[model samples]
Structure formats: C-alpha cells, structure tokens
Target: MTDLDPFTDLLDYPMYVVTAQADTERAGCLVGFASQCSIQPARFMVWLSKANRTCRVAERADRLAVHLLRRDQGRLARLFGAETGDRTDKFTDAPWHPGPGGSPILDEVPAWFVGRVEKRIDGGDHVGFLLAPETARNLTGSRTPLLTLHDTHDITPGHPAN
Candidate 1:
C-alpha cells in the first residue's frame, strides 16, 4: 500500500463538501473521494471518513447534499476542512438553506446536488455512499472551475483520525 501512495499522490482530483441531516443533527465535511460511477443511470459516489461527524449523520440520513466549491473558495473549504463539527456549528458559520431531505445547501458553492442515499459500502477507513441525484443546481455557468485536491493540500482534517 505504501508503494501506491506515490502514484496516488500524483493524481489531482476535485474536492467536495458533503452535508447530511438526520433528525435534529446536521453535519458536513470536506471530501476528496467522490466520483460519478455510472453514466446511464447517473450514479455518483462520495466516500466519507469513518471518523467524520458527517459520516455519523449520513448513516441515518435519507439524502445528502454534495457541493462543489470554486477554486477561489478556499475559505469555505477551510471552514469545513480545518474545523471539527463536534465543537463548531458549521451551519451557523456559513449561509445555507435546508435542501431536499433536510440537507444543508451551502450558498457559496458553484454547483450542488441533493441525492438520495441508495447504498452504503464499507471501504476500510472510509465508507462509500452511493447516491442518486434527485435535483441539481449549477450556480455558476459551466465555465466556472472547481476546487481540486491540489488546491487544498494544506488543509488539515477537522475530524480526528481513527
């Protein structure tokens, strides 16, 4: 696995913020492991770390909101990435609205989607959440570039490592 680290580190992928709400609890966190797994049926998967507060909320959430930040939105990224939800109310620190299934939709994101959680797959320290988009909004035009993992390399994880 150590040998693969060098290869994986060379890949520059987009980063995202995934939000979930279950009952009265709401949580969100920065995620780098997400991708469109299918094209025909339009399926997307986002991996949440087992140690993240968002993962706990997402376990019981019926739907989740996925947000794409602009390249310049590093502040928004850090808010979710560098601060733990356990001690901080991330929703209060940012502007958002209750989206479908009660997921918080961050107002500053360039694009976002509310998806129904169809399946959950355990993958080592992270769990892959398979989502089917119920609704999507592109706040910015297609020309807007998104933030990538390379752009957020300096951020430290808000959640403690397990």
Candidate 2:
C-alpha cells in the first residue's frame, strides 16, 4: 500500500451530497471525488465507490442529481454522508422530487443539477460516472459557506471497505 494517505491531503477539496434514483428505489451519498472534466461539453464526473449502496442503485440510473450543501446543513450532510443507504432511508427525512430518469432532486439543497450519465469508467475501487449537464439551476439564497472536506474529516465514511 502507498504510505501517503490521499485523504489526509484532501482537506482543501469541496464535498457534496449526490442523489440518484431508479424507479421507486432511490439513494444518496456524500461524495468527495467529483469535478468538472470538460470545458467545451461541460461534463462533470462523480466517482462512486463500488462498495457504496448508492453505487448499486446508480448502476441502472440514467441520470443523477448533484447538490451543493451549505455549512449550516451539516446534519443533512451527515444523513447522506455519514450513514449508509443500505441501512437507512435518507430520503424519508428530506424533501425531494423526481427529475430526469426519475432521479430525485433534493429541494433543501442550495443548488442542483440533473445530468445524463454519458459514460461510466471502471477505475479500480471506484467507478467514474461522467455526466453531461442536461439541466442546472441555482437556488435562491445568500452566499453561504459550503461544506468542505475539512468540515467532514472527523466523520467516518458512510460506506467503508466491505
């Protein structure tokens, strides 16, 4: 194994809670590895660990909804970020609606986007879901501090190696 802990240096990266749905089954997880990959096509990529319950649901998902949560929503982040969807219904406690491919769009989020999964690449432990921005909208709110990797460093991963 590598001696360096990549996570130790991830403090500066932004974090987000990403949600997806396939029919009646829905799931969400707090993700740290996501970013824009293309400038011309505006493609964004979200890496889901193979062990995550959300990854199971995402296999059949046609679209995914990504959200940016504010710092005040740490509890919300914990619900999705610190808890495994395999044992908990994270959506039951939040407000959501169906979006592209029947994916759930959380209303409590500060901003959201519905993207079509154009390609999925197997990247060893995690798979990258490349999304083409189908639609995006910003919620009305004052500029608020976003939840960051540093803010969640103390919390254990919702889905650890299994």
lDDT of 1 by residue, 1-162 (tens): 577888998898999999999999999999999999998799999999998889999999999999999999999999999999999998888899998878899998989999999999999999999999999999777768789999998988887644
Cα lDDT tens digits for candidate 2, 12-114: 6778888888878899999888999999979999999999988888888999888988878888888887799888999889888887767788888888898
Stretches off by above 4 angstroms in model 1 are 160-162
Candidate 1 yields a Cα-based lDDT of 0.92
List runs of model 2 lying over 4 Å from the truth.
1-11
Winner by TM-score: 1
**lDDT values of the candidates?**
0.92, 0.85
How far in Å is the alpha carbon of 146 misplaced in model 2? 0.8
Candidate 2 colliding pairs: none
Best by lDDT: 1
**After best superposition, candidate 1 residue 13: deviation in angstroms?**
0.6
